[model samples]
Target chain A: MIEFKDVSKRFGHTVALDNFDITFAKGKITGLFGPNGSGKSTSMKMIAGLNRPDKGEVTLGGLQPQESKISIAYLPEIDYFYPWMTIKQAAGFLQAFYADWDEAKYKDLLGFLRLEEGMKIAKISKGQRAKAKLLLTVSRRAPYLLMDEPLSGIDVLTREEIINTLIRDYREGEQTIIFSTHEIAEIESLVDDVVFIEAGQVKLAGSAEDLRINKGMSLLEIMKEEFRNAN
Target chain B: MPTSRLGMFSKLYSKEMRELAPEMITVIGLAVLAYIYLFFKTHDYPFAVIGPVFMIGGMAAFLPVISSFKLLSREWKNNTVYLMMSLPVKGGMIMGAKLTALLSEYVLGTLIAGVSGFLLIYALNPELGQVLTSSIPGIGMKLIELWPQGLALYLTSIVIIAYIASISFFSQMVGKLVSRFSGLVTAVVFIATAYLSGKVGDLFWLNIDKQWFTNGINTFDLNVINQFLIINLLFSLALAAVIFTLAVIIYNRKIEL
Candidate 1:
């Protein structure tokens, strides 16, 4: 489980996360939905130990994010891999650093993602790169997985590819995944819970099905409604 | 804890060296090509190869600043800092590995350029060739006698490179903090660091008055040489520790990206 207790962060005059408090359930898929600059990335980064909170704390399984990084796998919103690295070389590089890295799963995901092992990261299309990032992140059997905008720049076909691979590869009984994206419809079917954030605050969060039933709207509609209400 | 730490650093070091090789090759390759071109253009004149080779030796000293900046900047510029900061590694290990890598590159570049120039000179001139042929043992002994000065030069070069790179590393770290004028801030950091290093050097060694040199004793006494080496070395090491600590603190605490 991951917990944020009154966590707040700011960049100059702009507040990224405002005294935010939330706890994600263990072994479930949670969807963080927000528009641009709604603190989705900031919240994710704080949990991944890339961004420190100014006011409070973010913890994973009773440990701080930085202290538990080895047990957490983070898929950032940007293309962060070295451009010169081929798929095989990248796998080797990760293998050296992560004791939990699964070689068998990595090889299987390479086939599932249809990424050639010899292809340089720079040469791949953006959608393929997204898949590559997902491949690397999910291959680690981490207790917590934080993914930001995994489907942001991909096409519908690639989005489906990612969605299918994530569902097929995820061991839900043992692992928890929190993924954020503006296109909620793409992941609406997969998420067990939903969080709607606006202006650096959480406006709505609960079981996805419960919220859907109570509000008589889909997660996407609820997100739009919540953002409108917050504004 | 220390064992795993060392293991982690070893992996980081090898990765850095691997990434650094092709770039190093490009610089040295260009220098080699230029040396050849200049030689072809000027070989007809007396002692002309020496001029071009000497230029190669001097051109690489300025690269540590640029290399250090690039090594630190790419993480933020490419958004790779996310992956970097998220790793289960210490900020100290990451920064230390980078510093060590850049330092090695600087030292290796100097060695290559210096040796290339020396070999070019030794292989080119007929008078030198004849002297070497006639008195090989004498030439070898003379070269052996140059060891003290050579060692001093090597140590001095390493310290100087470390000092410049530490400032460059800190400037890049500070660049991530400011909203604008990062380049200007980096320049200011560079200038301030250099000025401080000079002042520290002056303060510590000015106490060693010229009376040592003016004494009736021989000018190149072992004590005098040892005093100069010891003072310069201590100063260099002290500044290196300060700048490196500041860089690491900024890396661990201040950098957001």
Candidate 2:
């Protein structure tokens, strides 16, 4: 589980997160929906302990994000593999550090992702690299997973492959997953909960079913109406 | 399961070494080629043989410093710092792995150069025995004559180089800490600090009884020259350790862009 309590982050005079408060329960896929620069990635980074909040706290499983880092796996928006490292080498390198890393899972994921073992990450296509990054993170078997823009640059088919792989392989009871992206429709069916962030603040959040029932419309329509009405 | 500290360190260090292998190989290969070319051209076998050693050692010594600059800077440029900072490992561990790998590469490269140089010299000049005997001043010199001492001295130079490398790594990390302009500031600060520290230390003692200084002002009977080497070694290692530690702390607390 993760909780952000009055978390505010600022870069110079620009606020990246503004008094944002939200809680993500365990065993569910929570979609962090926002446009570019909506602080979705920033929030996920804070949760991953990549960036510290200027005020308040971001806690995972009752500990500060940084302290709980070992228990959480993070996949950043961009590809993270060292350019010169082959797929197998990168996996081996990561496996050496992460105690819970599952080698079989990584191999299986690689097979599913259709990535060659000996191919250097730099030489691979961008989508393949993204898949490799995902494979690396998911194979860690961390209790919480934070994925920032994992499906951003991939084709629709590849996105579906990724979503299915994530759902089928990593998703399990009592394991929390928070993913940030602007492509809400792509993940609409997979997400159990939704947090709509705008202007560094959480404007809407709750169970997807609850939101749909109360608003009498699909989540996307509600989101569009909310932004339009705010403006 | 708990892992041994040495095992973890070795694993991390090895990973870094592998990542840097391409660059290391290219540099060493170039040095070898240059050495061979000079060996045939000058017909001064010793100089040609020694040429590669010096070139390789110099490259080995400086490559880490240069590589580290790019490595640290790339994190910011590529936006991978966010993911790196989020990992569970301590920043010090990350830095230690990098430094360890750098030193390992330097050591391995130097050894290769030393061995190759010796072989080349021996092959080109069959009068290696005469050269050794002629260079010695006396029995002591004869006892210690050969390339071994030179090799040892070269290794010592690497230690000095390593200290400088640590300073560079620390400066780069600090530069990352302060902002974009802080990189320039860090370079300036390092030069200014080094200048001031050296000047101040010299001002306090201008060769005033090296023995007295070596023996802590009381035991003046101790040999100053021997003590000086020990003191210098200790100072260099200490300075390296401190800089490395500071870099680790900054890296640990660093906020990824």
Task: Supply DockQ values for each candidate.
Answer: 0.50, 0.52
Best by DockQ: 2
Residue A34 deviation, candidate 2, in Å? 1.4
Q: For model 2, what is the alpha-carbon lDDT of residue B190?
A: 61
Name the candidate that leads on TM-score.
1
Local distance difference test values of all predictions, in order = 0.81, 0.76
Model 1, which residues run further than 4 Å from truth? B1-7, B38-44, B126-143, B213-218
* Candidate 1 lDDT tens digits, B1-257: 11256667877777677767887887788777876676566656638787777677766666665778887777777776777798888778888898788878877877787777666666556566555445335233444454675687678777777878888888778877898999899889888888987897778677877687456135445566666675677678778878988988988887775
lDDT of 2 by residue, B71-108 (tens): 66665676656655765678777778877777777777
